[model samples]
Structure formats: structure tokens, C-alpha cells
Target: MGVAAAQVVDPGSFKVHHVMFTELRKLVDRIIQIFPKIEAARPRCSSGIKALCSLNSAIDKAKLLLQYCSESSKLYLAITTDAIVSRCHKSKSLLEQGLCQIQSMVPVMLAVEISQIVDDLRAAKFIPDEFDEEAGKVVRELLQRGASASDSMEYAEIKALQTAASRLHITSLTAILIEKRSIKRLLEKVSDSDQQKKKILRYLLYLLRKYANQIIEEQTDDTTDRNEGAFGSNDPNTNFMHAHAFNVESGLENKGYDSHSDKLSIATLPEEFRCPISSRLMYDPVIIASGQTFERIWIQKWLDDGNDTCPKTGMKLAHLSLTQNATMKDMISKWCKKYGITIQDPSMQPDVPHLLETSSISIASFGSYINDLRLPLDISNISLGSLDASYTSDGSRNKNGDGLNLAPEQNSDDLRRDHSSGNASKLDLESLSSLAELDWESQYKMVEDMKNHLESDDLACFSMSSENFIEPLIKFLSTAHDLHDIRALKAGFQLLSTFLNQYRSGIRCLNEDTYSLLSLFLDSEVTKEILDIMEVLSCHRSCRSKIAASGAIISLLNILHSNIIDSRERAIKILRNLSLSTDVCSDLVCLECIPKFVPFLQDTTLARHCIVVLRNLCCNEEARASIAQTPGCIGSVAILLEIGSHEDQEHALDILLSLCSQCVEYCQLVMDESDIFAALFDVSVNGSEKGKASALELLRLLRVTNHDDRQQECFESSNVAPEDANNHAKEKKSHKALFGVKFPIFSKKKK
Candidate 1:
């Protein structure tokens, strides 16, 4: 037997059930001692073989039960103490009965041994351990309040959670995540037919989520404190809304409800999987006229009750019609099969009328086990028709019968890359690795000294053969927020820019947290250096949002408008990069940046840069309208067609197309500028292939929207060559008309 294997579980790990397990061990050991004598006697009668088989089955069951108790979650064991005690008594009872039956058939010596074992089993009384007695009292209190919709965060409930967490040794995030996964596995083990078991599992899951949420809130607050100090924000209104969005990313170590089991948790199940009326897993599912699904018997009963509202959405039914949802039936069948869940017949009454209120664990033990939720279970309260209108599941008996085949927990620490290897020289590797292990003060001292030597080193003309070596080292910049030394901060920002400039494509582990170090706190000492780094990060299309939120948008705007600045060019480039995200563009528009950006369009060197930024801003509806309304914004963009690069000319044409299409007035605005018509003619005939396509498209948009008479007037007003005008008119004649259709700004909407 695996009796020794069960005993291998750490004793402290199962503090609540220690006493029960100890008695179980004693009983199992006594039976093991008698097994040898029974085997040696080898009684040949049918009765002897039958009695021996019964004893063997009981022993195997006991071993498995012990193993389950040892390996299961401590909190699970603590709450299910009643079921644990009852099962122990039953295991002992069956063993005693088997021994009594075998006594008559066994040989004289073995029969004497069996009678003593039966006597010992009868003398045993299975009860919860001392710790379980306290746990039971807390559980009873929780159950009394379980009918409420809240998390029961009153002093008593919180104290109970805290006490239980301490007992289970689940103090770390990693432990909570592991315990959550364990409970989730147990939830998957439940059969659909076992509603009582499902409730207990659901309640446990709810409690664990509350605990996890509390931990998340605390950690988030700590990080927000550090971030606020680094950014120098004192506004009480400055809430960390981004951190609260952790439900999608930071929620529980990226387990993220990303697992199949999480997706199928009953709380978040596909609505169709549950019958709206009973708020239980649906069987014999049927779709009503409102397209909501329900169990056939419930829908039939609802119809028979003279009610006609869709139970889920509460809309009046188009008609009282029900169609069998074969698709739902098939899906339910596949889900049950995949998870090994058993669906019970909804029509059949459960064998135990009050399944949760077991004989061994009566609700009356808790004075007034009130289940009153003021639930309007019928037509009067449609809101109560929700699944959650019922009380939470708790303390009902769960069995470990078919048993669990739990995989050993995995350690992911080994999966991370070892920096000590790869193509870098050992000296370089040690130097890089040492920086990561240093305190912030020492790291600042080292990075400052290393940056100066790099610029003058013999290796300046050459690059590392492994090109990606800098990516792993980029994580060193994550500590930049903690350093207060100005020169060291400046040196770190310079290296960050250099790494990104040289290894942007190769970099895979860019720390967005490093971007937070870009606050105006260090503006006087390292604004130029940090702005340079932001310029590089912004060049990556995916990194723009983090850059925009890094507390430097104000610094960048100030640099843009400054009378004297050494970093204005880099500031403009960063803004251009951020313009790619429509959200950033809308922020710029709200800041009244179009008027500021309009002047940059006339500076030939900055014209291409300004026009390109405006072009990206044009992607957002508000920004597009703002640019159209800004005086000279359109003309400046049109100037890019003549003075800009081929790429810039294409962007210029795109901006005009956007302005023209947004409203009839902007279309006429483009028409009023015959210089733009001439630029369009020039681009249509001689610009790059894409530029020519855009130029023609903008011309077509102008022609389609202004109608032929208005377009001819704008063309007649232009001072274009006769031949170019004829060429433009001929091109327009051959193009297909798109009169009322609005283009989905380059095939997708941004922002």
C-alpha cells in the first residue's frame, strides 16, 4: 500500500487535520499488521475469498483518502472538516463490517487477529483536530453571512481570512497564485450534476479571489507611492487608474484567467451554458424568440406560468416560441466530456432533500442559519433572476472518490536566460551582471564611469557581434528611478538611448518601467539626455503609449515652445513618434498643439517633420477636424508636396484627403487653394508610385464632393500650365466616382 507515501506530506502543512490524520494512520497501521497473518492462512472457502476482497478494497480506499488529505489545499481541508470526519467514520465502519464477515470463514489463528482489529476499529471515534474546532466556528459564522452579496469584509470576516491565510502559510503572491490554481483544479473536478459540491467550490473560489484582490491592492499602492515620489506628483486626484487596469495583465501572475479552467469558472461561464430561470447549468437547452437560451423544462414551466418575458435580458418576447438549441446541447456535452463533469437530470430531485445540511453537519449548529436574501424568486423581481441572486456555496460535503491526478507543481525560475553564457566576453558578462546585483547608489556610480569610457574606447568603431547583448543589460535602466544623482542619471539616460539606437530591433525585453524615470524631477540636470532616450523609444511603433505616459509629455511640450533650447529637435522627433498613437494625437489636440505645430510647417528643414506629425494626427477624428480648422495648417501641409521627400509628399496628400473627406467645407478649402491643385498635378504625374496614387485619390475626393461645376471653377482659378490642367482633367474623367462613401481612413479607424 501507499500508506508510507501518504505519511511523507509535511505535518505542519496540514495543521487543521493533524489529529484526524493521526488517528487514521494508527487504524491503517493496525490493519497492515494483521494482513500478513490473513495471507499466510490462505482460507479456500468462497466466503473467505469474498471477505478478504472486501478488506483489500477498504485498505486501498483508506490509503487514497490519506493521500488526498495530505496533498489537498489546507484551506479546503479546514472548511470541509465535517465531511472529512464523516468520511473517516464511514471508512472505519466499512472496515469493521468486513472484518466481522471474515471472522467465521478465516482459520482459528487469523480469525482471532481479525476480531481484535474489528474491536479496535469499533473503539475509534473520528473527530476534527483541535485546530479544526476553531476553523469550524469561523466557517459557521461565514455561512451565516454568506447570503449577502458583499465580500463580508467586516472585522470578523477579514480576521477569519487573515487567520486562515496565516495557518496555511500563504503569505506570498506566489503561494496565493498556487493555491488559486489548486482550488481551480478542484472546481474543474466537480460534476455538473453535483450542485451541492459546486456551491462549496464556488464559495471557496470567491474567498480566494477576495484575498488575492486585497494583496493586489496593497502592492499597487506601494508601487504608486514610489512612482508618485519619482514623478513629484502631490495631487490627491492623481489616481493610479493604469494600475487598477491590472485585471487584464497584472491579475495573478499572468495566469490571467488565461487558462481553460478559468474561462469555464461557473461565475464567468458562457451565459448560454446556464439556464436563466434556475441560474444553473442548463440541460435540454432551448432558444426562445429573444434568442436567449434556457433549460427546456424551465422555459416550459415559465410559459405555463403565464409569464412571457425573456428571463435573461428582460425583454418582452416577440412570440412565445421555443426551439431546441442543438448547438448548445453539443457544446455542453463536449465541455462535460473534456472536464469529466457529469450533468444530472434537472427534473429529478436530489436524494438528499437538503444536501448541504447534512446529518453530520447540521445548519442548526449555527444559531439561525438564515438564507434570507429577500430573493423574489418569481415574476416580481426580475433582477433576482440572475445567477448571483442565490447565496454563495459553502461547507457542503465534497468527496475525493474518483481521485485527482495532479501534476507536480513546476518551477519557472529555471526557464529564464542565464546572463553568464552566450557570445559576450567573460569580462563584459561579469561587468554587466555585477551592475544588476548592485545597490542603486553603487549602480549609479558604475554606470556614470562606464558611459565616459565607452565613447573613447578602441571598440567605438565596432559593434558587439551578438548585437542583442545590450538588450539584457537594458534592464539595468529599471533602477534609474531610484537614483537621485544628476550626473549619474544623465549618464544612464545617454546609455539607454545608445542601446536603443544600436539595438532597437534586437531588443525584446525593454522595460516600460524605465520610461517612468523620465519625469520632470530631473529636468534641469538631464532633460537633453532623457529626451534623446525618449526619441529612440518613440521610434518603435509599439512603445509610444508608455513613452507618452512617462511624465515627460509636459517637459517635451515646454522644450517645443522654449525660446532657447538645445534639445528642441529631439523633442519634435519624440512628438512625431507619439503621434502614431491616436490617443496621443487627441491629447495633443486637446492641448491646442495644432497652432504651435502650424508654425513648424514653414521651416523647410522642420516642414517635413511637422507635416508628418500632422499627417499622423489626422488619423484621429478630433485631430483631423482641428487641423482643418487651424488657419494655414492645410497650406503648410500642401507645401510638403513641393519641398518634401517622396515619403513626405505622400503623407501630405494623405492629410489633404483626410481634411477633404471629413466635411464639405474642408473640401472647398482645398479647392480655394489652386496652389494645392498644382501640387496635386505635379505629384500625380511625377511623384513616387504611392504619392501619385494618393495625389489622384485626393483629386478624386475633391472632384466627387465639390461636383463637376465647383471643381471646374477651382481648376479654372488655378495658374497651372495648360498641359498639366488637361492631364488632370483627363485623369479625373477616367476615375470611378465615390460620391457619398467615406474611406475607412487607410482601412482602419484609429482611436
Candidate 2:
């Protein structure tokens, strides 16, 4: 214990990059001080053991980040300034949060020490210091030059990067090769959805190889210049580096299919088919807010890192939902087939028909994972709030609280009611009508001013209750926009968005044109702005029919299929809001939106919205019947019960129960899916307080259904069996019609 505590390095003891992890370093000192008290007590409760292990995991993350910053190339570190600072802040947050969780769990004598640790955490602040600015400037110049330049200007550009590399102390071919590979890895991990960035990365990789070749190709007659076995005549890493330079020279130069090349070669895997996070061919490609597609696991990791931004474009995400990119996945599968290549999907494999099996985990680094529940010696014997159906690296999780959002303001739209008075708020309707007459440049400036007033002046927000308020906003936002119209449209939409967000009553003032105009802009530059206004407006009871009639739902269904995540979420939010109406629910069902929404059940950000929409729609018998008929919908909801939040899990159970209660055909649909059965069984035995009640209730409902079906089958069979005694096949099926579920869960006592 003493030795383990000693491993906590103080800020003063750091040998290099002292300013980088200053906050984390201060927290480490506090941990070291408290370690002695914890070591002596060694509290054995389940909570205590779990908290310690969680704290240990956080510490491991911090240590690895600190070590990587110290050993990695300074230029690489400098170029990724935001990412590095984000890591520091993330580690500090975890340490602070983990320490607070541990305070209550630790023994009484050590509780005060834990409190002191929290105090140290509160005082430390992590602010980004000025990094290696010269190195970053060199990278920027190189990328700009590479974007538009020829051999005539190549020598100057190449010389500039080389000089910067030398200044940052990167001199050897081995070092250059390492940095080049780092860039390649980053490129593969970042999606090509942002085309300009993809092009810039390819060019940078080409330039580094070009510089390395200079050292390899040069020969000297004197001391001025010499290149003889520059990478050493025999080293393996260097030799591999030399070969890599050749292979990448043309491989990344043009990202297109080479029909003349061997299709069967493993080297022929197209870059676009590979997942940004996994660097492997994606079986399940999902698009996020930046319009980039990534493997579901890695992108979820990006969100948990606490910045709700796209991995490729660095754009702020509207939400963390991942929409399935079916086109890309299909293309990937076809490409694999054409090349005679094989891929594995863990979910597709044949497995034991149980929920608590080993089919749940997938980690790149280790074969097994041991969480805090497993660490506690008495945990299994205690049997508390835990289940065998665990979520792994690819499973559902909450957004780390550091992001700007918390849960979508619960029932935010329900707070709005229509107002009749525009004159009471003193609106300038005449000035608002003149927006369409202004030129684009002048219009954008005017829109910016409006947004600033709305942002800074509380009275402007208060004026949103006026019936005429939406008229001016719509006049600014509703004009038919083009590519050239992006700035004014974006600014105008932003102003409208600000109005809707700041004052809840603005939604009450929206008109037919407001809902109808959104459909036209679905394919425009201001799609984000359009969706934002519609998401809030669709929540109003009176607006649902108009929003559906405008053909916006169909466009939203299409947006759900596209690779842009930002637009995808706003689109779904609108759909979810529209689903509140029974007529709109029927419309969504006819449009085939359930299958689209079901694919995102495992997504953390969008799961609640999906389930709530489904649950609300299930209240309508026609919609419930349609959901039961939809393939994979019930099964996906079952997965949600296992992976969703406590409240959502209960809602999932309610959806299944609602469908099953409708008829025996619906009950049979519930029984047909093995995952659904297993999920229910798991929840009944080991789910949350609310979830367990819902699961048991659903199971009881299913049992009553199976019993009625069995009685009917037996009555008919009694008359037919005397003549045809060999008809046990029908009887055998009826015997097992309960879907492998025994009725002991809620067994009735015999009188």
C-alpha cells in the first residue's frame, strides 16, 4: 500500500512539461496524503471497494496521458493543442468526481481526509498555456502550401517544414517516420466526411515522406552534405520505415479505385470503408454531427471525453446520437465480397440463448475486463443492484457531465401556450417586413444585431410571447435561400433559434408558413438552423398536422439515413415532437420511421427520444399494431431495456407489454424474439427498482396470454387426438409455446 501510494508523482517532481498537467498533479499530492488513512482502514463494503477501483481506473488514465505528452513528438503535441488540453481537463474532472464518490464510502476515520482531497481538487484550475507556437505555425504553413502549389514552389515548402522539425528537435529519419505514421493513424481515425481536412492530411503525409526521401537520396563528396546508410544499414524499424515511405507514396496520393490493381490483395482495402476509430472495415458504420462516419464504439468514446464535438470536423454536435449509415455499410459489405474478404460481427454470431453470457465484451487492449462489482470479495454473495447483462465498450452510456447539455430539458415544449396580443409587447412589425428587401450583406448584419439584442436584453426574450413576434422572425427565416444565402439564413435562423430557446412561449406563436418553410430548407446550407426551429415548433399540439403535411417528416426520414449527425438529431427531435399527435404517429408508421429510429437504440444521446416517441405512439392502437408488425423494432426495444436508463428501460418494458396486450399475434411476436425474452428475464431478476417492477409486470401479462392460448389449443386437441394419436407435433409446439419462460416468476398459489 505504501509503495502504491508513492507512485502518485507530485507537480514539483515532474521532469518535463510541468505546465501541462498542473491540475492533475495537485490532485495526486492530495491522494498521496490520504493514502495512509485508506490503507489502514481497508473498508470492505461493496461501495467502498467499488469507489476505490473507479478512482484507480481514473488515475491510470491520467498517468498514461501525462506519459504520452512527455514522450511524443513536440510538433504532434503542439498541433493537437485543444485535444491535449481537453485530456488534462478530463483527467482532473475524473479525479475530482471519483474522490467525491469515495468520501461517503470510506471508513469514518478517513472520511475527513477524503474531504480534504476534494478541497485540493476545487482549488486547482487547468488552463491551456501557450504551446510550441513556432512548430504549429510551420504545420499550418505546410498544409496551406500543399493545398495549392506545384514543384516550382515545392522546395521552399519542404525546406520550411524540415527547419521547423529541426527547431522542435526532430532530426533523425526514424523520428520523421514516427511522426509521419502518427499523422497517417490520425487520418485513418478521422472520417473523410470533411473533405478539405482529408485532403490536407494526405498532403501532409506526402510532404513528410518527401522530406525523408531527401535524406535517403542525397550523397556528399565533403562534410557539407552526406547521406550514407542514413537510417543505419541494418535496423528493422528503420528498414520498415524506408519501405513504408514507398508504399504510401502513391497509395494515399489519389483516393480512388485502381481497377488495374489486384482486387484480392489485402492492401486494397479502401480508406473510406475503414472506421475512423477502429481503422478496420466497418460492419456497422454510423454518422455523427460532423457528417463523418465512425465505428459506434470509438465515436461514443469521443463523447465520453466530455466535448460534444465531431472527431473529424471539430464542429460542435447538436446531440450525441449516431445514425446508422446503411449505404456505407452495404458498400463495405459488397466491397468485402468483391475482394473475397471476411468480416466479423459479434452480434451476428450464434450464441447461447441467455442474456448474462460472454457475448457482451469487446476491448482492443485486453481479453477480459474486471469492474468494481467484481473486485468486491463479498459482492456476488451480497447480490445487490447489478446484472450479468453488462454494457461493454460499444454499449449505451450517458454524456460525461462536462458537456454544455444535461438531459433535454424534460418536457420543455409542454410549457408553451399561444398568446393573442402582439401589440402589448410593442413589436415593430413594419421594420421586420423589410428584411426581404435588404441585400444579403446588409441583411446578415441586421440579423446579427437582432440576435445580440435577444441574447443580451431580457426584454427581447420577454417579447417572444407577442403573437406578432414570430411574424418578423419567420419573414427573416422563411425566404427561399440558396448557397449564397447561407450567411443571412444562418444568422436569421440563429436569431430564431435564440428566440425559441430563451422564451418558451415563442413556439405558441409559430404559424403555417413556419412549419411549411422548414421543408424547403432541408437541403440548404441552413439545414441546422431550420431543424432547430422545427424541433421546438413540432412540439406544439396545433403545429403537428402542418409539420407533417409539409413533407418535412419524409425529409427527416432521409436525413436520418444520411451521414451528418448534427442534422440527423435535430431531424429526429422534430419527428419525436411530431409523434405526440395520434395522426402524426400514424403518419410516421406509414412512412416506415420505426425501423430507422430502432437502429439508434444503443446510442446514448438519442435513446430516450427514440423510446419516448415509441412509447407515446404505442398509446394509439394502430401505431402499437404497426410496431408489433415491424421487424427488429421489438428486439431493439428489448436491447434498450438492458442498456437504457432506469426510466427508459421501464418504458421499453411498457411498450412490449402494450403490444402484447393487444392480441395473441402480438404476444407471439414478443415471444418470437429470443433477445427480447432474455432481456425481460434479466430485468425481472436483476434490474433497477422501477425496471424490475415493469419487467415482472410485462412477464405476467405474457404468461396470461400464453395460458389462454394453451387452453384453447387443448380444447380443440381433445376431440381430434382419439382418431389421430400421432399428432403430437401440434401438441408439442403448444407445450413449449411459453417461449422458454417458466411461470414461476409470478406463480399463483393453488387453493
- Against the hidden reference, what TM-scores do the models get? 0.35, 0.40
Global local distance difference test of model 2: 0.58
Residue range 412-521, candidate 2, lDDT tens digits: 33112101112212222232445556885666666676676556432244323334446755665645354356677788778888777655545666666766777878
Which parts of model 2 are misplaced by more than 4 Å? 1-440, 463-473, 476-484, 602-604, 675-678, 688-690, 721-751
lDDT scores of the candidates, listed in order? 0.58, 0.58
Query: Tens digits of per-residue lDDT for model 1 on 1-751?
Result: 1111123233333434555565666677677677655644546878777677666556545644564576456666776666677667766766666566666554544554665466456556565645455655565456545544344444555566655654444445566656655555555444465445455555655555545545434445543465477445533113222222332133223331223334346434566687766665776899899998888867776675567887668889989988999999999988777766666564543222222222211111111111111111122211222223222222131211222111222233311211211112233323344666677676665665445434322122123322333533445554454544566666677765554554333334455545665654325667777777677677766777777676667677777776644576677878888888877887787777788888888776666777778888887888888887889888788888888889889888888888887787788677666466667878999999999999988878876665654456466749787787778666543211222233322222336
TM-score of 1: 0.35
Model 1 residue 362 distance off true place after TM-score fit, in angstroms: 64
Clashing residue pairs in candidate 2, if any? 189-276, 288-565, 289-566
Candidate 1 — which residues are off by over 4 angstroms? Answer: 1-427, 432-445, 452-484, 502-512, 564-566, 708-751
Error of 2 at 361 (Å): 60
Q: Distance from true position, residue 130, model 2, in Å?
A: 43
